[model samples]
Target: MKPGRNMRLAGLMRKEYLQVLRDPSSIAIAFVLPVVLLLIFGYGVSLDATNIRIALVIEQPDNIARNFAGSFDQSPYFAPRSFSSIQEAETALRRAEVDGIVWLRSDFGSGYLQNTSPPIGLIVNGVDANTARLVEGYVQGIWFTWLEQQMELAGKKMTSPVQLEQRIWYNPAVRSTDFLIPGILAVIMTLIGALLTALVIAREWERGTMEALLVTRISAPEILLGKLIPYFFLGMGGLGLSLVMAQFLFHVPMRGSLWLLLASSALFLWVALGMGFFISTVFRSQFVAALVAMVSTFLPAFILSGFIFDIRSMPVIIQGLTYLIAARYYVTILQTLFLVGDVWSVVWPNAATLALMGFFFHGVVYHKTKKNLQ
Candidate 1:
């Protein structure tokens, strides 16, 4: 009896595998989609601010003003276009030709030299608040450095009372690509794992195959296992491909144990797949299942998972809500493993959450399938 049941389960798995291969959409979702998304996230999205265009308006030309303006030209961060008057600079800014404008008034030389805080105007386009903030910070840094140099040239003792030495951990270079790629991996896995299985049971229902399968000798548990096994491998394959792209193409470091990363990824994939299966079981239409899977999985993974935005900076309620997002745990694990190595303090808790979620989602799927079968 046991051998017959095992054989039946194997046959069901084989049937699912064949069905996956025959479906062009499933093949595209399992394989092609990961690469396209990796390329898009790797190349198209960037957090590093560089080559910012700013108009420099000099009301009066002098040695002091020229020296100050020269510093902006030297910095790689800014592309300074000199304007004769504030009006010209304002025109450039209004036309969106520059991100910011630095204006040095006619009294800048005398007032600045006398420590009167010269009327230096920094007008920044605030369309993108984050970019505006970064530009403002960079400009202030340039101004301070120039001030320090001017003081030293005058033979005055220029020193800060307290010096700050900043050291960043995990990602020492502070490259956004290194930070982004790992989160992209989590998002990609979520899309592939959830979206694929989201269509499975729904497709079975649409084709009138669910009733036929129910009347067969195979039990609901065996059928679910059969569906789960094939797609589980498919999800893992997507993960492997995404990891290779992250390491080779994007040059993201993998400081953790490769085996451990794979293990945690497997746990996360289980949760994602189980969530997809639950959606599939609940919604009979393929279109509805796909939409719900995307809305529930992809959006939460991208937004609440701390992929691009810091959950800590969000409102208290939104921060509290992140605890419910499954991708939050997976993103933490991926970032830690890829950037910080296997810090089990971080990895253990997140992995445990993923395990619990997997069990919960799969248990719900099992209960629903049994009910539907009856």
Candidate 2:
């Protein structure tokens, strides 16, 4: 008599577990790869720009000029180097010794004495526009603060039409490491869930083991489940390792519910697994399957998932394309869970989308595999 469906599924899953143990590559991909990636992204990469080098030129070394230059020296954002003349400062800027130049004219003290706005000249290297803007803003902040101090010492209030108070939210310190480490989790899962499974299944096909399994009395759903169950646990193991490193090594805060993070991760992992199954089923060659998986899943997840780049800043066409990338949604969920607390508004929609994509891909793979059996 034919064995029961449950019996067949259990037997197939046991076989897959044995195969996973025998393969070292699978273990490395799931464990070692996350460590390497986390280290590279957490330590090697940074977006917070600090200690900008600036050359300061004072045409007349008066008390006001010296005091104004001292403001820049006190600021942690600037590393101020005094130059005797503008010509020397400009040359230093050209030679890349300094990122910016701050020039105080001879009229600086007189203008402040006459109760007028003293004009200051700022020259910044425009080669890196983002850094240049930051330097300019930091210089302006110093100037305004010095102006207020001068007014207070003179026993007068500085008259301005508007007073602005700024507050930074979410990541108040604005450390890029905090922003990047969470997003890297999405990339890790993509490799573990999509690339690993794709290569393993493709290897099975190349070795003729897949054909041997297909000739058995095992049904299509049973075969697919057998492949998925083992890898799902493997992917979760990788996820657990990544989380431990992210929390202890990198010190990224997890403000959301741990259960919620795990649930979303599971949903996205399901989608990634379905994607791998689809790719391997289409291309039985391991090389072709790996290449396709990297191109189709890894590259898109890295570039279009709003990990390093802002999605709103992309071209509208590209932004719309991001909606199709499962990593995009997963990255959003991760960032929210890590940086912000349990914000259901952000989490629910993204998780639901992942669920839909998972169902769609798994359903397609099921149909395709059933057709192969026929």
Candidate 3:
């Protein structure tokens, strides 16, 4: 009986493998999709604010205005384009030629030396709120530094009681790519695991193969296991390729054990695959399954998984909804392992959650498959 079961399982797995090989779309999802996503997310997307373009308008051309404009020019953060009139600067701003406008009023030459707030106007394009905020902070920093320099040149003492020293942990240089690539890996895995498996059972039903398989001696467990084993390896292959691209192509570091990373990734992939299988089992239409998988997996993974946005800053209801996303836990695991190493305090709970989710999804798939078989 054991030998017969093993032979049947092997035959089923072989059939699944042949099917995967025949389908170009499946191969693309398993292999080409990861590389494409890595390139798009790694190179095309960025959070670091630098080289902000600003139009500098000096209403009255004077030493004070020139000096302030000089200060902005000297700073690496600002690429200043000087304008003779506020109207001209506004034109540039309207055209999106500059990210912000710095206007020095006509009274700036006299008022600036009086130790009062200078008649300087800052107009920022607030279309991208984050970039505008960054530009505002940088402009303020520049203004303060220029004020200190002017005080020193005039032989006046400038002192502040408190000095702020910032230390960033995990990522010292704070490169966004380092923080992003790991999360990208999670997203890539979610796509491969969920999207591909979503098409599996649906394709079988559409092609009239599920009924034929049911007429055979194959048990529900054997059918499900056959579907999973091949795709599990495919998912792992995609994971491995993504890791290599992250390290070699994008220069992302991995501080944790490779084995531990693989283990956690396997757990996450299991849950993702189970989700796909469950979706496929419930909705036998390939189109419906694919659409549902993308909506339920990809969109949530990108948004609610803390990949680009902070969960703490979101609305309370949205924050609570994130708990249901499997990618959230996997993303946390990936970021910790890649940036902070194997911190069991972080890894254990997330891994357990993924394992539990995997079990729950696969159990549903099993029950559904059994019902369909009967």
Candidate 4:
């Protein structure tokens, strides 16, 4: 093709753009999906909890109980309710009115003040394991911090018998959005790219227009590339907007290489497109393909990926299962890029993983399309 004919690429691109624009469902995924993902990930997925009500079923109105409850009241996250009897607190717990119930034994006052151990009870709602763990940590940490301060002033240096020193890498402060933003990039792009591709490709097949194009002797790869170029730009635009939102709106810093950030995101988008293409190839209905692609891509990215939650803390089987998620590696890239700049230790490995996943997914798309062609 000559220089003048190369300009035909622009017209081809424009045609592709117009076709996508004409499809209302395709347009919705491009424009509306990002906002939906941001909303869901922003408000829905959270670690910074506040005003978590705890019923203090104080068997004895001892100094320790009062002091603990008072300490809880001071914190932004805790709302303490002092109850005279355990029965009232139990009722509240059963009713889901309180997240946790703290019970003090009769000897709590004397035992806590003295060298003896104070037997305290902590009953938490086990419905949400993550929340339950956080509540438990807060209650325990607060009580111990208080005790340690008291002991220190009285010429006692009491080291915790069972000690745990947790240090979060990359994101030391552990901001929810800091952890979430990168995974959200993968999730949203996957949703938009895959869902949109499935619909657009399926629409062509459904309308019987693809059959006319098939006779041109053009390879499937060429057609796939043509289809992908348009969507890739759209996906990149969405990624850029999301990055801005993460930085300015959420206050998450971008501490790593901008090149690394772009490369990783680009690879993730490739995988997402492949996922969508695979679905569309197998299933003709845009709605069905979109639903399947979104569910498979989004949930794993959010849940299984080590973005907001730690995979190390989970069971061995669960930890093993995380490898199946491409977002797991992508989340590492995101954190490294945003918080730890030029740390090749983290950057290189994750970059390689993202590339591999992209290749694997694209290969699947290629094989599927080849089979369909035959």
Q: What is the C-alpha lDDT of each candidate?
A: 0.91, 0.92, 0.91, 0.78
> RMSD for each model, in Å, please?
2.0, 2.4, 2.2, 3.4
TM-score of 3: 0.93
- Per-residue C-alpha lDDT of model 2 across residues 76-183, encoded as one tens digit per residue: 888899999999999999999999999999999989788697889999999999999999888888988988897898898988899898898788888899999999
**Any residue pairs clashing in model 3, and if so which?**
none
In terms of lDDT, the poorest run of 10 residues in model 1 is 365-374
Best by lDDT: 2
User: What TM-score, over all chains together, does every model reach?
Assistant: 0.94, 0.92, 0.93, 0.84
Top candidate on TM-score is: 1
Task: Kindly give the stretch of ten consecutive residues in candidate 2 with the minimal lDDT sum.
Answer: 365-374
lDDT, residue 25, candidate 3: 95
Better of 3 and 4 by TM-score: 3
Q: What C-alpha root-mean-square deviation, in Å, does candidate 4 show against the real structure?
A: 3.4
Q: Is candidate 1 or candidate 2 better by lDDT?
A: 2
Candidate 3 CA-lDDT value: 0.91
Task: TM-score winner between 1 and 4, please give it.
Answer: 1
Clashes of 3: 0
Report the lDDT tens digits of candidate 3 across residue range 1-374: 59988999999999999999999999999899999999988998888887899999888878988988899878888899989899999999999999999999988987876757677899999999999999999999998888888889989867789876788989987889999999988888998899899997899889989988888888889988888999999999999999999999998888999999999999999999999998888888999999999899999999999998999999999999999999999999999999999999999999999999999999998888862544
